[model samples]
Target: MPLSEQEQRLLDEMERHLLHNDADVVSAPSGDRTLSYRNLVYGALLLLAGVGALVAGVILGDVWGIVVGVIGFAAMLAGVMFAVTPVRRATPVTPREATSAKRQDSASFMDRMNDRWDRRQDGR
Candidate 1:
């Protein structure tokens, strides 16, 4: 059955309240995890170049080549990391989830203090 008018109104009010209170959470990026194909290809090419440079440096025992190889390796790492990194993760957050967590933390803290007070009162 559909929600009653009062229920609907309550829900709408709750939504507005949640949005107002947790506007930052709602606007925060949720990590879109799509990879850019172009970037991935470029990353792969860079990795390959780095590997080749490192191998050539090791085989020839050239210090400058080794330095260049390390730089290439760094570039490859950057490219690969950029390609793999998520733009944003899609997170569907509700006010209840946020508040519930906070409430739980606060409740735990209060419970601990209350328990201590009770123990002291009971002299045990």
Candidate 2:
């Protein structure tokens, strides 16, 4: 069955609201840290080397092979950790500044959402 006019209108409004809010979420700051391209590249290189070592170890087989494989595994683990870990900002964000900044950003957003909810509940 097709949606009634009121239902369609509500759906449209919901879509608009979702799109607007989604833009905010997408653009929101990720905090005082970021990933480095240099780190990523180095990590990838390390990971590749680890894989090669692992394969070489497998082919060699024996006590030494086991040691090489373990080392390779550790290298791979380190590479992954290095790649994903975010670097801290040079200047640290003060707790008060962080809280105030976050509150200022989110307060308006929450208020808007609350107003919308109120309007919606009131059948406006």
Candidate 3:
């Protein structure tokens, strides 16, 4: 079932207002939240481990320690990249746009049918 033009416009307007309100709420930053002390301590431990690997590699002339250090560094870089990327949202289609798209689709379908009919006639 298709919506009438006026109903579609009302829906679109309501959607825009809701998105605007949501944008305002999300943009305000509250700074009361504190980082977990345990997590911070664990992060420091990981940093120390990386430094230890590098120092041990240089002191003992072991190439495998260097490889371990490189792998840890790569993992950290990948985590940062994943955190910064934004999630994409789907755009809502209005009734007018939907109708236009349907018309175009039907036009192409009719064209294909006409071509098939012409081919059948030629063959017969």
The residue pairs that clash in candidate 2, if any, are none
lDDT values of the candidates?
0.66, 0.74, 0.55
Candidate 1 per-residue lDDT, tens place, 58-116, comes to: 77667887787787778768767866754533554465666655544555455765897
List residue ranges in candidate 3 displaced over 4 A.
Answer: 1-33, 71-124
Best by TM-score: 2
Model 3 per-residue lDDT tens digits across residues 62-106? 678677667556545544444443433344334365455445455
Cα lDDT of model 2 by residue, 14-52, tens digit: 554454457555324357876778889989899998998
Alpha-carbon deviation at 6 in model 2, angstroms? 39
TM-score-superior candidate, 2 or 3: 2
lDDT of residue 84 for candidate 2: 74
TM-score of 2: 0.51
lDDT (Cα) of model 3? 0.55
Tell me the RMSD of model 1 versus the true structure: 12.7
TM-score of candidate 1 relative to the true fold: 0.40
